[model samples]
Every structure is written in structure tokens, then in C-alpha cells.
Target: MSSNRLKILHWSDYACPFCVIGDKRLNEVLEECNIKDRVDFEMKAYQLDKDAPKKPHLKMEEVFAKKFGISIEGARDRVDRIAGIGRNEGLDIKFATVQFTNTFDAHRLTKYIASQGKDVEKFIDLTFKAYFSDNLNIADRNLLIDIAEKAGIDKKDASKILKGKEFSDEVRKDEEEASDKGIRSIPHYIVNGKYVISSSEKSEMKFVLEQVLKDEAEGKLNINE
Candidate 1:
């Protein structure tokens, strides 16, 4: 429970399919090592589709098609493949029904939740399920508040955070830091502020956790490296 244990800065976007899968696998590794008690898990902000419009809400399939210059059907197939990967990680992904909303507000809410020192893993899970599985409009204030409340956060606090522009600067700062670090994708985990692991591979995730834990045990964590 010491503050000196390994700190993991996890950068992710809720809309990204790989992030959800990677998070689940990382949670499994943390559970196995009982590192939750010894490590600080911080969720960093990243926006995959920063210029996405707000109105005339775009379905994920169409969004993919436009982004990749593919047909809608092709996008559907690609999303199905991604959803299959999610299924392997035990996620109930309904890509067809997913609405692509700007996650700037959601990222702000996440930063606010982190400020309270609550379990951000649960918050991220709820947000992912709300958007990808439940097909809820995460950008909507009421929906965001409801999701936050369900994650054990106070409804009043959630309402206040969602209503105003609170934590917006903090979220933007995290996003800038991610850009400076050249993290171009989601599910990026930086351990001890040194080890960087991208992608959602279970084996790679486990290896990162083990390495961090070994460093903690041996007192040889090179933060500058």
C-alpha cells in the first residue's frame, strides 16, 4: 500500500475496441499479482477521432468507412472482426448499434473521477459498456451522470462535473502528454513511467506486469530508462 510501488499510466479511449479488451486483460494480471494494493493505476486521456462531428450522429460502421475509404459493408465486417476479439476478452460488443460520440466530455469526467481517488477501472468499464454494449449516448449529460452513479460515484458530483467544463484542462493536458510521448493508439500502458507497452495482447500485458513487479521487489526500477 506504499506510494513507492509501480505506477501505471494507462492511456485509452473508451470508443476504441482494443482498449476495452486490453483493460480487461490488464485487470486480470493485476488481480493475480495483488498489485492493485501496491500500484497506482492512472487512466490517461486520448482521442482517436478528435475531429468527429457532433450532430447527425455517426454509426461506428459509417465512421470507419469514411475514415478508411471503405464501403459500409466492409467497415461492418472489420468491426465484426474487432468485436470477435472483444468477445474473446469476455466483452459483449454490439458494434452495429454503437454510436460514435465525441469522447472529450467522457475523458473530462474520467479525470474528475480520478481526482476523487476512486476505482477508475470500474468507471472505464461502465463507460465502455454504456457506449459499445448498451448503445447509450455518452455525450449526453444525463446518461453520463447515470453511468458515473452506477460506478459508485456520487450522482451530485457526477452531475456537477458533467454540466460544467470541469476537468477539461486536465484531460487536455493528459492528451498532450500522450501526443508528446508519441502514443498514437489506445490501450497504451506505461509502467513506472518507463516501460511502454502498446496493444492488447494478454501475454505482453502479463509480461509487463511481471517486469514491473520484479523491479519493485528488487529495488531496481529505473524511471529514467
Candidate 2:
């Protein structure tokens, strides 16, 4: 049978703690709405820092301080606030100690996972945990292969894909699409390709998603428009 499941395109990067928290909140709200099974989600690659080092260059606190021109102490305060949100969601995310490395390869891996007709949700969550909670170098091929293995991807296939340049174009394509849409932030979401739910509106996510689902069921969304 054919189903018109609510299609959600999410743009985010593993480097982002907000993406981690926002994703958790979204899922919780979806479950509350009882529409999780009726939704199809696709996570799009959106690099928070394309120029971030392939190796761990700086701790997230250092990056935070530099970006906002604040002291290390102040940076700790800011990132800790975000981390608290994750804790509330039962995610062990420590943003201050996050391994700030390039996430391009991680994004590529997600594209590869999707190509196999698999749901990338669990895989993406693991990547975030690896980068944030475990403080692992997501750019390291070896670490990524292990993460892939845990996500049910064959180790040999993961190694081959990471070793070569597989899914590079798809990663870049997602970035280009975000640019075309004038997106200037991580954790951007497009529902049914018409309704946009950015991080700023997270507090009302349940109500917003409920409306979207109701509209979708009523054939009111005309998503093609």
C-alpha cells in the first residue's frame, strides 16, 4: 500500500550540540503525537564549520570562546547550558569537551547509509554520541568504521567507503541545497517541504508538528506547492 507519510528534511552537523538536543526534542514530540511511524525523516548534511580541522584542533570550549569573543570560563557557561538540555533528554552530551573536528566524512557516511534504503536515525544519533559524549574524533576513519559497525553496517564496506571518496558528492550536494535555500544555521528542518521548523521554535514543536500532521491528513498541505 502507498502511504503519504510526513516527509521531514533535517539539516544539521555532528559538531552541533543544539542539533543533538533539537533532534531529541523532535523525536519526543513525534512520539507524543503518535505519528512517528507515519513520518519519514531524512537528515541532510550541513557543516557547522567546513574549515574545522580533520584532527581535534580545539576543545569545544576553546572554539566557543573564540567564536563569541568570550573567556574560557564564559564559554563553559554557554556550552554547559546546552549540555543541560541534552541531560534533560537523557542524552549524555558534554559539549564543553566535545571533539571539535571536521564532520564532512561523518556526513558522507550518513549519505552512504541512506543509499542502502536504511533509516539513518540511529546512525546519526550514534555519530552525535561518538562526537559529543565519547569525545571521539569523528574524522578518524578507524573510529568511524567502528561506529558504522555498531550501526549494523559491514566493517569491510564501511572501511572501503571511508577509504575512498564515496558519497562525497551527496554530502556536497546537501550543503549546496542548504545554501540555495539561504539557510544560515544548523538544525534547520523542513516538513512536507513546506513547513519550516527552526531551532527558535523548538518550545512549541509538539503543537507545530501536531498541526502539520493534522493538515497532512486533511489533504491540506499540497506539499508539491
Listed per model in order, the count of residue pairs whose N, CA or C atoms clash below 3 Å is 0, 0
Every model's TM-score: 0.89, 0.92
Candidate 1 global TM-score: 0.89
For candidate 2, the per-residue lDDT at 24 reads 81
Q: How well does candidate 2 score on lDDT at residue 204?
A: 66
Sliding window of 10 residues with minimal summed lDDT for model 2: 199-208
| Tens-digit lDDT string for candidate 1 (38-92) | 6667889888877755442777888889999999999999989999988877889
* Global lDDT of model 1: 0.82
Candidate 1 local Cα displacement, residue 185, angstroms: 0.9
Worst ten in a row by lDDT for model 1: 49-58
Q: Which candidate leads in TM-score?
A: 2
